[model samples]
Target: MQKHIFNIHDVVLFMTVAECFLLVIFQAILPVKNQLANRLLSTFLISIAITSACILVLWNDDVSLFTAFDEYLLPYFLVIAQMLKGPLLLIYVIALTEDAFKLARRHLVHLIPAAVAVAWLALFQIDSTDLRFRTLGMTETERQIANGVWHFIKIMPFFYALAAVNRVRLYRIGLHNQYSNFSPTEPSWLNILTLGFLFTWSFSILVHVIANTVALAAPQISDLFGIAENYIIFILINALFVNSVVHTHKLLTTKPEAAKDKVDEKLTDTAIQKVQQGMEIQKLFLKQNLNIDEFSKRINLPVKEVSAVINKHYGTNFFEFMNSYRVEEAKRLLSDNQHADMTVMDVLLHAGFNSKSAFHRFFNRLVGMSPTEYRKQNMNKEVKIA
Candidate 1:
């Protein structure tokens, strides 16, 4: 009993369970919103949960824990989990590369075989004389039913191989079409998801094949091999949770100018109206804490359109325009003798500079001198007056 409690396998099993729960929570709260990556992520998380639960039931100490369900229920779960990985990966690739992802009604047909396998396994387990279950393990001659299920699920490698090649072809098409225009440091979250899932699933299938092949020769190594399945599920869940949350948050919290650049695709007929609106909008932007999106909306132009117009016609982007206004305000603050003792950063912050680096960069570019240099020039005048 003590050995069972301290088993390495049990530790891995619990960790896998914990990861699945956290993944579920992340899925519920931090959904991918409009992104297609979320669909793949959801499928992967569900697959991990199903896989982990199957393992847990297989390794459960007492048969009474699932007395109503026969031993064959375990293989059914494994088969379903195995079948899900390929389609999830294929869909992930589609979402990453394709702008439009409409799931055809026929995709559901892929699951029919797995469903049939599960139902057959269930029937055999109930009828003690069933050949497949008997061969899989319920009888005294074959005690390791779970290991047999692992062996049976290995057939999914064919599905994975087919999907992987198809994904590569689709990815090439995506490159020529939508993905060709994306800049390297731009938020390519779907690309990340596509590549990451494919790499992970490929490695997982390789490990499963190698482990099972070796186990056929040396049965003792089977326990060690079983451990990999649980570990893979744990890693996949953790990756999904961490990567999805980080990528989603980064995209959502991206700088306003950066977000604008992402949404601007073409020059259109409304360019004149946008430019005129931007000119009027520039005045209100001088106010501290002015929101770009709100200003754009108030002016009845899309934010990206307003940003593009300002960049093209006004000769400056939104950040530069806003910071220029702030810097002018800061210059006014500096000229006032009453606040002469304030630091450059303090003046900048009061005038809406979010960072000293930003203030320094903008000041040098626009004013042709550093803030400190300007202060020294003013000091020389003050000294001359004194």
Candidate 2:
């Protein structure tokens, strides 16, 4: 019975790792710009890899090499996984703080301890008997050392949960003031699902730690713990992936009728004058590379009104609207003779674009063709004219 139980748990563990790995691959391959989503997926992948590797090394007897990998590697891996939890939460917060993410170089220093721990493990060449690692069948002290490290790592998830809760609150408050209508910019379902996932993982980790610490009656109980943890992680990952896929599909197929309605409703005679004046003011500042607030002030419209008008009428925000004009000007500059020798990049910057990638993104989005392709087409037209 015990052998069959272990086999079942092993299958679940391997399947969990495979599913999570596919999720990581999906995130890497997909054009997901949500930094929170990216960080969560990445953290899960790294943690799952390290955990699965340690589990196989500790439990698998099919390969002698894995069995001989030493218990020291387990604690080290667990500590690193623990250290990543806090930062992953912070990354989620930073990602959602604003649409334009600015992750500071200094914040990366958070990984210093994890790096040092790994370096210590490698440099000292610590044996399995060291305080960091010991087998479960060893002395009570050794068992404690093994179990304690896992428990310590499990506590880090609470830090992540706290950060997530605070972020959700802030998100709700920000949306309440920012949007004029339903304020559905903050998706309630997503918020609830994210919170539910964070807590589910947190509780599972805590329970696993507690179960191991107490030394339950049957070692098979650990199998139960493993199965539960595996299922929760698997479900959470798949839920997020499915949500992203479905949301994207709907966004592509259903052209945001609510936003369209908002646009149509606001394009009245009085609103059209406001939008026209806003656009004209916007054009004047395009050459100067002005920001949203500056354009809002110049047009004498509230920032929310400005944002709404641009988002609705132009089907883009202030930067995008401004960039469309700049890109058009850049194309004209590229086609003119005085600057004929200048590169496309040179003309892009001279026309107020900040970066090459930004220029390409906006150009492709607005022009429906790559900058190089557009340039080639225009050049051929000039050739025909000559």
Candidate 3:
């Protein structure tokens, strides 16, 4: 074994391991809407910490703990972490996004891959001459098999990252559907984590593929690439921690989705008219920081009936329904030179929007132009006098 010397790379990786452990502890103590999801994420972080720690141990031959564990034991055990990560990542996203997601006994089917990995590791360990760790001792055929198996093992995380991105997409769509005027921080961590997974894992897949190819004796090169991966993973874990600690009071929760079935017959057209008339007469949508419940109470109606009218008749959720009115208000403000001195920020605030991003997003989506562009173009419009 070529014993590795400690360097800044080792220091960075040690910090990664330390970060993972501390994050795990923080998650355990933190309160979340879904404890199962928190625990799953913590477990995933633990696997990374263990995997990184094992690599650190392997790099520094000074660590005699490997000698105690029959040299190849810890290395082979790493396969379980590799296999479990894909399943864990997917489940964690599901738990966070799905309000009704219950971790039942049957969900344990995800463990099958890890169990198989353990059995595979046992197969190699039963033979004292482990072909996996001792590549030079293996025949050409054995090396080919080892490399093929390594490629298969590396694909698991890639698959999970894809699944998580899809789940987060649905969750984002639901968020936009339900709420009005979200701050940047709302669901930003989830977005950061999902996109970060895709960004970080692409390097991992490429590194493993290149490392295991027999034509390219690139294990040493692979180790170099892994340092970059560790840095990104370190950033991602820290981002999670920062968001969790800061947003602990306002923990994210999923609202139950409206059923696609027919609207209740009891919610009469008269009730719908009252909701609409009250909204327009009072301009209730212009109320700052207004929510559906407040909107309902202002109109002197049940919240369910108010939500049903917006969802079923207007063909939008409470958020979009409110923004539609706000967009119209913004357009009216922008069209007239009377408010020409008003900035886009001023218009957004007067139109009942708290988030500039949400203001721009809705205005652009509905009007097909930026708020500033719309303002500049229309401010010069002249009224026709016949």
Candidate with maximal lDDT:
3
Candidate 2 — which pairs collide?
none
**lDDT preference between candidates 1 and 2, better one:** 2
What tens-digit string does per-residue lDDT give for candidate 2 at 1-386?
33443466567667766776777777787776564557565675667656655565455544124423555455576567756755665565446444556567987786775676566556655444454244345666555544555555566566666676666665554443332112232355456656865676677686776566653577566666666776676676676567565552221110111233454456545554665775555554344445555665766765656666666666764555666677787778766767778888787777777567767877888889887788778888888999
* Tens digit of per-residue lDDT, candidate 3, span 1-386: 98566778887778888989988988888777667877888998888787677667755555546464536566465667767777887888778766678888998988886776667656544321343346456767666555544565677778778888887777766665545655556466777787788778778888776666532565677777877887888888787677656753353445556565445444588778977886688898788777665677878886667777876777788788888999999999998878988988999999999888889999999999999889777755644421
Q: Which scores greater on lDDT, model 1 or model 3?
A: 3
Show the lowest summed lDDT stretch of 10 residues, model 3: 124-133
**TM-score for each model:** 0.51, 0.55, 0.74
- Computed on alpha carbons, the lDDT of every model, listed in order, comes to 0.58, 0.59, 0.73
**Angstrom error at residue 160, model 2:** 1.2
* Per-residue lDDT over 134-197 for candidate 1, one digit per residue giving the tens place of the 0 to 100 score: 3443565343443444444555644654675566554443332221021222135444544555
Clashes of 3: 0
- Clashes found in each candidate (C-alpha, N, C closer than 3 A): 0, 0, 0
Local lDDT at 322 for model 2: 69
lDDT of 2 at 351: 77
